[model samples]
Target: MSLINSLLLLFIAILISYLLVQLMQWSNLFDKWLDQISKKEDPSFGNDTEGLLEVVETLPQFTVSDISGQLIGIQELIDNKKTLLIFLNEECEFCGSNFEHFSQLINNYKGKKNIQVLFQSNQKETARNFYDVYDGKFSVHLYKKEVISEVGINFFPAYLIVDPTHSIDLITHNPIQVAHSLNFD
Candidate 1:
């Protein structure tokens, strides 16, 4: 992708993230409601990501090499399980700003056998060290510049949830909205 297109995608990502945050915080939307007299919870007072994540057209067939030079196919990774593909770069300013949220997200899904978390970074030299921040809680892959574009990624700090059906379920840049998007419930 050219610099202009990349900048455009980054702008769009930031805008979408901002709009979602505004929507989430729209008029105490996340506030809790309780029955004062009955001392019971409100039946219809629950929050969910009912419409935040739209259906992704799915990723193309592509195989990427990890830091250890292992070729992992996207289809194979999603077989009989879900794969959370994280695209990040060590030098990305936006990525650096969201490190805390990313850390929390990694921690949330760490050691989850039912699903697989794969981290993709372009920093070859910092591949293993970059993940050390997360205590190597998940697998990190190093891919060529074209590989990210081949996978339809234009920006850093993006997340994709791929299901066993060979489709990308969710793609978002906001870490706070990840849980809402990953509705395994």
Candidate 2:
């Protein structure tokens, strides 16, 4: 084959390989890479990525005004109790399900002032409307879209569980699992 043709074929092969690598990563086939790292160790059965949806690398302490116009800080909320931080966008269907789950959790934790349901929203109007829907069940907060985007939460409805000491416990996509993990009672 000509040198130019050979070079072209090489470039196409490289491109295809790169795309396949990305696809594998996107599909979360990290097991193959993990296996290479450890041959003796068997993969953990609890290797589900769904649990990661509720996690925050470092639980940040910040003050945000609730829908009732009350200034609530993260530390203060979790000073002596757990907190459920829900990131919601009004248009997201997942968020609607999350809201219902939040209500169930609230019912479970009824009259327990320790558990605070905090909200972070992309749009103030949508946030306000969401607050209206919940109707004081949760301490909803509104934030700028860029703020949430900056936090690197690509998912629409992200849930984070913060312990009593204001430390992250788990991040999971399953709201039911989140409620169970937190032991909302």
How many Å off is the CA of 56 in candidate 2?
A: 3.9
TM-score of each: 0.59, 0.58
| Candidate number of the best lDDT | 1
lDDT of 2 by residue, 1-185 (tens): 69999999999999999999998875564464334324422234221443233234567656666665677666766676776777777655456766687568656643454434434543666667766776755666755455454444555566666677666665544566565565542
lDDT at position 113, candidate 1: 38
Error of model 2, residue 157, in angstroms: 1.1
What value of lDDT does candidate 1 attain over all alpha carbons?
0.59
Tens-digit lDDT string for candidate 1 (73-173)? 76776675776777777755456556567666546653463333344445665667766765765677765566566666555566677777767776665
